[model samples]
Target chain A: MKKLVIRSLIIVAIALTAAFLTNLLRPEPLAWIAGAPYNIFSDCPETAQHALPLKIGNVERERDFFVDARKAAQFEAGRIPGAFSLPYDSLFPADAAKVDEIREAAGGWRIVVYGDMPGAKLLADDLFSQKAGNVYYLEGGLDAWLAAGYEVEK
Target chain B: MTPKKEKLKTILAAVGVPLRVYIGAVFIAASLFKIYEPYQFALSVATYQMAPLPLINIFALALPWVELVCGVLLIAGFWTRANALLISAMMLMFICVLSVALARGLQMSCGCFASQDAADEIGVHTLLRDFAWLAVSLYVLLFDDGRFGADGLLEKWRKSHA
Candidate 1:
C-alpha cells in the first residue's frame, strides 16, 4: 500500500510538471489562482474595459438595439423586446459577414449583445474591434436580465 | 495456483489489456484539447455551476494532466490496479456531477471533449456513456493481476536476473 501511494504521488508530480511546462509555452498563460479583480478586463475589448460595470441594464428600450448572440431557437423562445438575432455559431469563430450584417441593421445605435454564456462577450468584442464603438454585451446574458426582474418578449 | 485464480488470470489476459488500451487511449485523446485550452476548459467548468469560482481554475489546470498520465500508465499496464482505481474514481465523480446537473435542469455542455463552445451538450446519452466507461474501469480493477503488458515483462526480467 505504501508503494502504491508513492507511485501515485510520483504520477501526480509528473502531471503537475507537464501542466506547468505546457502552460508556460502558451500565448495567454492562465493565472493559477483565478478571480483576479481585474480579470474582467483581460479578454474584454478596449472599449468594454472602460464601461465600468460592464453590464448594460434596462435594455435602453427605443434608444438602444439588443442583439441576441445565441442561437435562433433561443432568440425565438424568449428575448429582450425587439432584439435582433445574430445567432453566434459555436462551431466556428465569429463570422465576419454575419457580424457585419448585424452591425448594418442596428443603424449606428448603442448595440447590446447577449448570449447564455460568454458568446455575447465574444460577439461584442468582435463588433467593437470592427469599429462599432457603441457595442456592449449584457452581463450574465439573458438569465441576468430575468434575474433583475426584467420581462422577456417571447 | 487454484483453478478459480487461474480463471481470473485468464480473464485478465483476455480482456484487461484491450480494455486498458482503449480507455487509456480515449482519456489521452480527451485530455489533449483540455491541456491546450485551459482557459476555455475553465469557462466550461464554470458553466456547470458547481465548483466554487476560485477553484474552477485549479481543476481546469490539473485535471487534464492527471487524465493524461493515468491514461498513459493504464495503456502501459504499469501499476494496473492503481490506474484502474483512479479512473474509476474520476468516472464516479463525473457521474455524480452529471446526475446533479441534470436533476437541477442545467442546460450546458458536457465539456467531455473539444472546447466548451464545441463540446457535446450534456444529456442522458452522455451520462450513460460515462456509466459504461465506469463499468470498464471497475472490471479492470477487479480482474487485472498485472501479469500482462509492461508489468508482466518487468516481472519476467526480474526473475531471470535473480
Candidate 2:
C-alpha cells in the first residue's frame, strides 16, 4: 500500500514537471493564473458589426464563442450553448467581473455577441474597442438562434 | 485456495493485461493533444462553466500530464492497481462533468481527444464511452496482480530468490 501511494506521487510529480517545462518553452506561454479578474466594463458601442444567426452558426459550428448580452435573469432562463453571459445593464460586480474575465480569456477567438436589444451591439463594440478582435453582434439575438434550430443552454 | 476462488483469480489475471494496455493506450492518445494545446483545452474547460476561471488554466496544464503518466505506468504494469484506480477516478470525473453538461444542454465538444473544436460534441454517446472506460478501469483495479508485466516479473524474481 505504501509503495503504491509513493509510486502515484512520483508519477504526479513527473507529470507536473513535464507540463511546466514544456509550457515554459512555448513562444506564447499561457498565463499561470488566467483572467486575474480585477477590471471594470465601461466601453461604449462604436462600429459594431452584425451577423445573421445562420451565418454565425455556420462559422462557429465547432467552437461557438457566443457572448450573451441579455439580462442575467434572461440568461438564466435560456442561452446559446457555450455562450458567455455579459448582460449590458451589468451594474452588478459579478457581471462586470465576468466582462473582465471574458476580455482576457476570449483571446484571439471570433467572439459573437447577441441580445434582444442593442446590448449585443454595445457589448460587441465595447469588446472590439478593448482590442477584442473579430467581435460581432447577432442580427436577431436569441430569437434568431432559436429560429435557426440551434439548442439553447438553460 | 478453493477451486472456485483460484479459478476466478486465473480468469482475472488472464484478462487484466489486455484491459490495462487498451485503457492505457486510450489515455495516452487522449493526453497528447491536450498537452500540445493547453490554451484551447482551457477554453473548453471554461465552456463547461464548471471550474472557476483562475483554476482552469492550471487544470488544463496538469491534467494531460497526469493522464499521460498514469497511462504509461498502466501500460508498463508497474503499480498496476494504483494506475488503474487513477484512471478510474478520472473517468468518473469525466462522466460526471459530461452528465452535467448534457443535462444543461451544453453544445461543446467532449475535448477528450483531438482539438477543442473537434466534431465530437458532448452527448449521450460521449457519456456512454466514458462509462465504458470507467468499467474497464474498475475491472483492472480489482483483478490486476503483477501478471504479464514488470510487477509479475519482479514478484517471480523475489519468490525465486526467497
Candidate 3:
C-alpha cells in the first residue's frame, strides 16, 4: 500500500510537469480563465472606445437604429420599434456576415444593441472590433426598457 | 476447479484487459483536450454553475492532470484498484452534475472530451454514457487480475530478489 501511494504520487508529479512544460512552450498563452479580451473595452481614444450606455429616452429621442442581440425566441416575443434582430448566440468569429449586413444598413448611424448583459457586451465588442462607429448598448436590456415606459413592438 | 468457478474466472480474464484499456484510453484522450485548452474547459465548467467563481479556474487546471495520472497508472496496472476508484469517483461526480444541469433545463455543452463550444450539448445521452463508463470502472476495480501489466512483472522480480 505504501508503494502504491508513492507510485501514484510520482505519476501525478510527472503529469503536472508535462502540463507545465507544454503551457510554457505554447506560442499563444491561454488565459487562466475564459473571459473577454481586456482591450475589448478600451478606454483609449485611439482604438474604439468602450460601449456607451444608451438609455430608453435617448433611444427614443435620437431614433437610432437598434439591434436586438437576444435569442431568436426572445426577439420574437417582444422588441423595440424598428429594431433589427441579431441573435448573439449564433454569431461566431468565422461567420459575422450578419454584422456586416447590419453595418451596411445602418450607413454609419449610431447602433444600439440590447439583450442579456453579457451577450449585449459581447456583441457590442464585436461590432466595435469590426470598426463599427458609434456603437452603444441599452443598459439593463428589455426589462429595463419596459420599466422606463418604452413601447414594445410585439 | 469447480465448473462454475472456472467459467467465472475465464469470463473475468477474457474481459479484463479490454476493459482496462478502454477506460485508460478514454481517460487519456479526454484529458488531452482539457489539458491543452484549459481556459475553454473552465468555460464549460462554469456552464454547470456549480463551482464558485474563484475555484473554476483551479478546478479546470487541476482536474485534467488527475485524469492523466490515473489513466497512465491504470494502463500500467500500477495501483490498479486505487486508480479505478479515482476514475469511478470522477464519473459519479460527472453523473451528478449532468443530472442537475438537465433538470434545470440548462442547454450547454457536455465538456466531456472537447472544448465547451465544440463539445456536444449536455443531455440524457451524456448521462447514460457516463453511467456506462462508471460501470466499466467498477468492473475493473473488482476483477482486474494484474495480468499483462507491469505490476505482475514487478511482483515476480521482487519475489526472485527476496
Given candidate 3, what's the lDDT at residue A106?
A: 65
Q: Which stretches of candidate 3 lie over 4 Å from their true place?
A: A1-154, B1-14, B109-119
Q: Which DockQ values do the candidates obtain, in the order shown?
A: 0.19, 0.21, 0.11
Error of 3 at B159 (Å): 1.5
Rank by DockQ, highest first. Answer: 2, 1, 3
**Distance (Å) between predicted and true CA of A86, model 1?**
15
Residues A65-148, candidate 1: write the lDDT tens digits.
677888888888999988888876656655677667766766644567888656777777666767654576778888888888
What's the candidate order when arranged by decreasing TM-score? 2, 1, 3
Of models 2 and 3, which has the larger TM-score?
2
Could you tell me how far off, in angstroms, the CA of residue B135 lies in candidate 1 after the best superposition? 0.6
Per-residue CA lDDT of model 1 for B91-123, tens digit only, reads 999999989988997643211222334234578
Q: Provide the lDDT at A26 for model 3.
A: 72
lDDT minimum window of 10 residues, candidate 3 chain A: A37-46
Candidate 1: regions farther than 4 A off: A37-154, B109-115
Off by over 4 Å in 2: A1-3, A36-49, A52-154, B2-4, B109-119
Tens-place lDDT per residue, model 3, A1-154, is: 6764675566667766776666677787554554542211212212436566766655532436788988889888999887889878644741368777777766655678899988887887777677655578888888888898878997
Ten-residue region with minimum lDDT total, candidate 1 chain A: A37-46
Q: Docking category for candidate 2?
A: incorrect
lDDT of 2 at A57: 43
